[model samples]
Each structure stands twice: as structure tokens, then as C-alpha cells.
Target: MAFVPAPGYDPAYDPPVPYITAIPGGLRPGMLFYIRGTLAKGYTRFRVDYATGQYEGSDIALHFNPRFDGRDRVIFNTFQNGAWGEEEKKKDTPFSSSRPFELVVQITQANYQITVDGKPYHEYSHHIPMDRVTWLNVKGDIVLQAASIIGCGVGSAGSKGGAVGIPGGLPPMVGPVCNRPAIPFTANIPGGMIPKRTLVVAGHISSGAKSFIINLKKYSSNDIPLHINSRMIKNVLIRNTFLNGVWGEEEKDIQNNPLQKGQFFDLSIRSGDQNFKVYVNGHCLFRFDNRIKNVQEIDTVEIQGDAELAYVFF
Candidate 1:
């Protein structure tokens, strides 16, 4: 059966297999779909399809299939009028049985940019009109955890005129809702960090927790360009950079501490030309100056400590 679209951010957490839902606002440029799940043990194959409907023979705009039968590989194709189109295959597959995985599909004007974990994997050109796609179907040997459609900004999910800003002229881009992720979770920032790019981390702090760390690190390096350490016991939010094996002077000067034990919090960090603007629960928390001049190199995000992640979106 087709699921109804949800406004703003729509998410399904720990959904059953053969899951199908209507795409919120339909497909459009700059929107994205995030799926996180684990492959069952000894799994051979699984598929995710963007289709026109929820029926068994619905026309699939994009079929993403990963096969582990012999040599691990992924195949991309389309189905129209009960006929499968030419297949595009990639020999390497990033998914493994019994291992958790994160996948993001970004809708663009010409193609679908697929990212696995935190790296760009493939780009599949559009064979069917993206607007013709309305439902998302996932089936096969996988334990579906969380799936969400994001990047529509503050407007309603059915809005077609693009993201609309709030009354005060704030930016339109907003983070998607994510479910619980494994602790010590790390993912790559697609296209790397750049000005105007926003990262949202939402979760609940464990009761009687000590602290949690959120780091924006350089890919394949130990340098942490941005590190957020929230010490809940002390009520201090420490912001610092770790470069050359040394921690820079800590910036612990926030007027209020928004984090509380066993409470949910939404944290957003937006990159600027010279600083990172941080907001907590929709209020400006603090700003940290860019210590790493080359911001694009800071591509990995690491989160660990006493919290259950609701979602992480970049």
C-alpha cells in the first residue's frame, strides 16, 4: 500500500520490508533521500526502487540493486511498460552482510548522485522523468532501519515553489529527521565542507552522561577543524580545533547551556566564509572562527559519547 506524504521532514524508522511510501512533494532538484539499514547475514541481494506507484508491476524510474551472489556488484536500471532497460553495473559494492550501511541519493537536474557511507559512489542519469516518480519501495534481505526524504526546507511537503523562508528572512535549507544511529558513528561529507553548507545533528543525551564530542575532521587525517565537546555536568559547551596534535584554546563562552540529560536537542552548524554558526533548538548558540583555512578538506564527521542520535544530515 502507498504511504501518505508527511510535511517538512518525513521519516520511517525501523520499517518492515517491502516498504513503500509516497515521495514527499514528489521529486525535485536539490532534494535528497537518506536510507540507513543493515544487510541480513548471508544476504545475496536487495533492491531499492523509485517507482510511479506501489503496485507489483509499477514502472520504476530507478532501480538500485546490489548483488552478492558471486562477485559483489551493484546494478542500476529502469523499468517501463513491463520491460527492463539496459543495465548499468558497477563491480564494486560498498555494502556487506551483517554490517550497517548508510546511503544517500541526491536528486539533481540531470542525474541521481548516490553516496554510500560518506563518499560519492555513482551517478545514474535520468531515463524516466523524475517528476513521474512518486513512491519509494524497498524490499529484499535487509533490516530496514531508517529512511527519510529531506532538503525541502521549511515549506510544506506538497509545496512546489521550492523552499520558503521564515518571517525574518532566514535561509531555507533545513536538515532531515534521522533515527537512532550507532554510537561512534562516522560518515563522509559529500562534496566536502563549503560555505553555506549546513550540518544538523539531533539526538537525546543519555541520563547522567559525562560529555559528547562532535568533530569535523580532515579526510584521512588526524586534524579536526571543528570540534564540539559538550560537557553536560559542567554545563559548558567547548569549541576547539585539534591541529598538529595539539588542541587550540577552548572557546567556552556561551551564555546558556541548552543540553540536558535525557532530553532531545537539535543542533545545526552552518558553514560561513570565516566561521561556523551553531544553533541549538533553533536559537543561535555560538560561532566558531574557521581555524582550518581549507574548509573543503574537512570532510568527515565523527560523533561519539553519551547520546542516542536521532539523525545527522549534511
Candidate 2:
């Protein structure tokens, strides 16, 4: 799903090497993490583990080791009851000595979808309950650049990676914060929707909700490259684009019920070269062709209506 790191917990710049930070909440589906780093000279191996405790023998759920071990392979296994599980190794390696790389891992209910340098690489099924795994430990011969955790999924109590209250802890606000502000808010889409960067909107459908609108456009102009409106009354999700203040044709062939009243939904909009893909509840619901040619100009997002949004991160 398209997602932004939870507020406050997102790193502003490249973090220091050999870093340790609490997974703000814990692992859950729809959450994402990435490690940007370079292998050190004479690098033999590096390991990234998701564990219950920092101490040794603390029930590690996933032990990811990329090694040069002469044969050049990547091994994945579990450590339980103070013992290591049988290793599952694949020859496909995404790292090189003293070279920089980015690894993005997306957590789902059953598996972790890992991609290296924007390419599909591998999948690791969960050996332990993902939510029970807390700390993220990265060690071995590598230089860490940046790492982040984002919370935007169904029932994910992911590391808040930020300051203060949990993602869905607060009462769902219908209107404004404190008093004057509105719940339908807009925030900066950092780097302006770069490919591989996701846009996540999380919210609960209001009990008596009729509809809601999520628009992606430029602040300085009315050219909306993407306009997603969910009409619960009609049970359809409307997709459109506006050019020069003129609305284009509508798209609603997706027969799936994209939402349910009084329920929570995670909406992800992924940027592709030719289309803007939308997912509801982790299911692909719409794919709108790139009507706005230049996707980078889509800088502003606005959401307001019958749904109470938990957060929107891009």
C-alpha cells in the first residue's frame, strides 16, 4: 500500500551507522520499512533481524543475512527457543562490497515482500507472529545510511516511528482538532510522488457516511491528475482527472466494493509510469492512466468529507 512514515518517527536525514531505534509500535500488515546502506570494504556479511528482545536468544522472528560466504547467497531463517531454524538460502544477491543499495520491505499478514533497488526480489513467510516482534537490529559489515518505518495498514500497531500517541489511539474526530481546524487535512508530499514512494490515507467510514473525496492536484493550479471519490450511496468509486478546470470522463468499472460503512480502510495510491494505481483494503481497485503527463507536478492532496482520517502520508 502507498504509505508515509508515521509522524515524528520519520528520520529527517541519513541516520548514524549501527543504529538502534524502537519499532514505535510493532509490526503489522500495511507497514513498510527500508534500509539504505553500502557494504563495507572486505564485507563478508550483514544481518537484519526482527526480534522480541535485544538480548541474545530472545526469540528472533526473522534473521536476514546477506553473505559473501564464498558461494554468494542470501539466507533467511528463524531463531526460536535459543536455537536457529534451518536456513532458506537463495543465490539472488542484491548487495555488493562497499556499494550502496536500498531495500524496501512491506509487511503483510502472511509474508514480507522485499524489493531491492525497486525490483521484486524475494518473499519471506512469517515464522513468528509479526506483531510480537518489536526491535529492528541491523549489524555486520555495512555502512547504514537511512532507515524508516511507516504505519498504514489494517490493524497494524506498527512502530509509531514518531512522537506521542499511537496511530489509531485517539477518538475518531469528525470535524476539527480541538475546535477550529478540520479533520479533512492536507500535507506535503515529499519529493512530489516519486516512483516507489507511496501515498497512504487511512480512515474509518463514518456510520452515516454518504461519500468522500480525495483529490491530488497542484496547489497553484486546478489540474487534478487524480480525483478519487467514493460514493457509498451508489456503492462505486469514481475516478477522474481535471485539466484546465474541465473534468474528464469518469472511471468506475472496478466492480469490487472498495469500502464499507463504519469500517476502517487503508487506501494506497502508487505512482507508475503510465498510471496511478489505487488500492482499498490492500486490494487493487482502480488504475487511472496518467492524464497529467508530468506526475511530479502533483504536489497537493486534499481529503474531506464523511470519513474520519487517521492520517495521510506521502
Per lDDT, the best of the predicted structures is: 1
Model 1 lDDT tens row, 1-314? 12222234455657788788777556888777878788976688999999988798989989999999888899999999999999999999999774577788988899999988767899998888877887889988898767767765355333223333342333344433343568989888876777756677767688988998899998777799899998988889899999989999999987887776766566777776699888765567888999877787888899988987756776
Please state every model's RMSD to the true fold in angstroms.
10.3, 16.4
Evaluated against the true structure, the overall lDDT of model 1 is: 0.77
| Superposition error at 73 for model 1 (Å) | 1.3
Give one digit per residue, the lDDT tens place, for model 2 in 58-145: 8888888898978989999999988899988889797876456767777889898887765778899999987678778888887765
Candidates in order, TM-scores: namely 0.56, 0.52
Q: lDDT at 10 for candidate 2?
A: 39
Clashes of each: 2, 9
Q: Which regions of candidate 1 are displaced past 4 Å?
A: 1-6, 152-210, 213-314
Q: How accurate is candidate 2 locally (lDDT)?
A: 0.69
Clashing pairs in 1: 118-188, 178-310
Quote the lDDT for 93 in model 2. 92
